[model samples]
Target chain A: MSVPLLAPGDRVLVKDDWPEFRGPAHIRTPHYLRGKPGRVVRVLGGFANPEDLAFARPAPKRVLYHVVFERPPLWHEGEAGDDVLVEIFEHWLQPVPAERQAA
Target chain B: MSTPARPESLARLDRLVAALIAKGIVTESDLVEAQARTDRASPEVGARMVARAWLDPDWRRLLLGNGAEAAEHMGVSMAGAPPLGVLEDTATLHHLVVCTLCSCYPRAVLGYPPSWYKSFEYRSRAVRDPRGVLAEWGTTLAAGCRVRVVDSTADYRWMVLPMRPAGTEGWSEDQLAALVTRDVLVGVALPRLPVALAAE
Candidate 1:
């Protein structure tokens, strides 16, 4: 299998950017990090997305991006020790600072 | 072999036999022979392996480094099955195994997986909150042991060989194997038996 290309320090947003998928997937996203800001710290790897794999469709390659955020930044007035790091697919990410180009 | 069994029941039996054949546990040439052997064997082989590993350092290292090969030396072949990696528990690390998608097990090495190991409840909740699941299994870890939950996907399977208990200094391999249970091998149970308890 070909490795999906992704790198650390890349910024991302949810592909669907839905509130539900964000908060519920705790291993990737904590409830405090939902609707909060974060940045990619590690690029884990890539595989066929589970959604596509389940449907038996030929899924385009997707990279798994791990994001990091301070606990206080994610939660409004939350504790300091609750730092959050999450792994999400490449398609879910887009360039941060809107004007900066994603390469 | 025509009995008035219901179609569904017959289909279930066929599937069971097919699974057994695929695993090489049974063959057409010795169908009756295989059935008799399985009937005589305990359903807790996997558990026994776990317990034995916990008590033996050499065996634990062998299991963790090359599970299939080590199992083969013990007359178990983890062939035609997904690659299984056995994880050993230490003072700093603890391991838990779960099949996130489907129930894939190292049958040749550990024997049949328990019903709870393949349950939807265990599978779905394991990755989300492993400590909760471990708590249900009656295991409460000491401080500082990072719990690593391994997902057994289609490509890989995992078993946890826990650390040996403190009280058994002079025990035979057969005595050790008897303490190993299927749940312990699958990462759901811990091995805790004194020599006195083992003797009993």
Candidate 2:
């Protein structure tokens, strides 16, 4: 209902506890990127929250963010520094701390 | 695209089409036109744009910035389709397109969705481990290069404008386009040089 907290290019930490936080409910956030640190590549406007839409419930406009993660850090094995991208809902992300964001 | 789909699904589609026709919501001609439209939407359309972008700098800029406008200039029809997005691959940046939620593609420019693209394995992993997926397709980017994976959806559809390979100097647009396969358009593989294809 208010303005979105984060904008494009802000570093975000995806919350692992989503869609009931116990086991799993219908969700838009991918499983692998849970609790991972990544950077927002773009603010992809807003859409009906899929987290609620899955249950056929009314979903208000929610900001969508395109987040990018480096492969090696995100995964245990892979070439380092190659970026992986995903579109995640606003509720699924948290702003990283100021010091870590600066680094 | 020719891989056999389930017969029950095909029969269900036929029944749906029949219902539409009976209700006058659609006619046989409408189905025919839709079929023709999809048939015209092929990799060659994407390849043609890539070929022209290869030759013309301004055109490439226009193609990258606004794909629908560039497509109109090239006489490719994009009416009633979603906005187009062409992710340009450069020496430093590489791009891959996938619909992690569903199989959303630039079907107006790249024809029918490939079977592999719609597979659960690809939809599940492409966004999570793109470099590993690229490695599966024999594409390995350098350490410093950034691999951006774009998710195509209902609002925007994307295709890749792959970088031109070396050893093709003075080649005609057709020659360069000949090397641009559907996989290159999807960003799973690179356009092969003539020498590379010749060796195969």
Best by DockQ: 2
Model 2, range B73-177, lDDT digits (tens) per residue?
867777877667788898888888888767888887788988899998898788767777998998877567777777664356788998888777899999888
Error of 2 at B182 (Å): 1.1
Q: Which tens-of-lDDT digit does each residue in B1-200 have in candidate 1?
A: 22478999999999998999999988876978756544543425555556556566787777766776766666654556555567767877676777765676666555556677778888777655667787898987767666665555433456677776666668766666666666667666677685567576
**Candidate 2 docking class:** acceptable
TM-scores for all candidates: the values are: 0.56, 0.79
- Candidate 1's displacement at residue A4, Å, is 12
lDDT of 1 by residue, A8-55 (tens): 665555443554545532122223344555567655555556556655
Each candidate's interface RMSD? 7.4, 3.0
